[model samples]
Target: MAVTLKAEKREDLNKSVTKQIRESGYVPSVVYGKDKESKTISVNSIELVKTVRDEGINAIMSLDIEGEQPVNVMLYDYQKDPLRDELLHADFYMVNMAEEMDVEVPLHLEGEAQGAKDGGVLQQPLYQLQVRSKPADIPEAITVDVTKLEIGDTITVADLPEAAEYEFLDTEDTTIATVVPPDTVSETDEASDEDAEPELVGADGKDEE
Candidate 1:
């Protein structure tokens, strides 16, 4: 289900107006979609943060703009204050529920790999996956089980189970996770050994240059 978020139309585009909006605990935002005119708006900063925290980023939203009908939307992008770590602005993309769209979904590994338990290193090359699905059918995340993975074993996109709701857009050979033998020597250790000064010794057991 889509979460409903109330928003107010923004009229003033001046810097002062934007500063005031931020000071008032609201985030300046814009809503746009294909064939639809873009609208400038603002939403309560606290409410927006809470919604995203509770619902995953891929969660669909019902944007209730004042004086207009609600529209199905998704949070496309956002900006934040680098120093203050505060939300500065946001962008909402109005979505057509019936049309399929491509989105990146987070990938999660489930369970401990047998290879890792045996002292092998487990590596995840791809942490997210490109998926195509309708707005309502979009998944929160794609999970892969690695419990059975042994050393040198890899899980690729093709190994994933087929799903009717969404399709993976990545190439079949794209590796998601893998296990490999642990390195005997780290790069730092190797560099240190190479840079070490050699000890001098004589045939008679006396130190000599």
Candidate 2:
């Protein structure tokens, strides 16, 4: 179910007006979509933050605009105050339920890798996955199990399990995770120390041959 968020249309584009809106605990936002005229609006800051916190960033929203029919939207982008870390502005994109869209979904790794347990370093190269699916079919996240991975083994995009709901956009050769042998810096340092010659010291604390 889409979360409902109330919004009010704003006609004034004055800088002072935008400042006042922020001061009044509202975030100035714009709603837009293909083939539709963009609308400027304002939403309650507290409610907007709470909604996004409860729902993932990709959660569909029912934007209830005053004097207009409610529309389905997704939070497209946002800006925050660099110093205060407060939300300053937001952008919502209206989405068609039947139309396919490209989005980035969070990627999660589950289970400890066998290679890591055996002293190998496990690395995740990709933290998010590009996926294409309809609005209703979009997944909250994609998880890959790493329990079977061995040293020098890699999990690529092609290694992922097939899903009917969404399609991965990344090329099959793109690596997601891998396990490799641990760094040998300590062994190299030990060898270097063993090969070094001790320097003779003089009474003045200077190196002498």
**Tens-digit lDDT string for candidate 1 (91-206):** 99999999999999999999999999999888898999999999999989899999999999999999999999999999999999998887732654688899999876763432
TM-score of every model versus the real structure = 0.87, 0.85
Steric overlap count per candidate: 0, 0
The best candidate by lDDT is 1
Model 1 TM-score, all chains together: 0.87
- Cα lDDT tens digits, model 2, 64-160, are 9999999999999998876677788999999999999999999999999999999987889899999999998888889899999999999999999
Residue 200 local lDDT, model 2: 67
Model 1 root mean square deviation, Cα atoms: 12.4
Give candidate 1's error at residue 17 in angstroms.
0.9
* Displacement of the residue 29 alpha carbon in candidate 1, Å: 0.4
Off by over 4 Å in 1: 184-209
What is the lDDT for 23 in model 2? Answer: 94
Candidate 2 local Cα displacement, residue 181, angstroms = 1.2
Q: Give stretches of model 2 more than 4 Å off.
A: 184-209
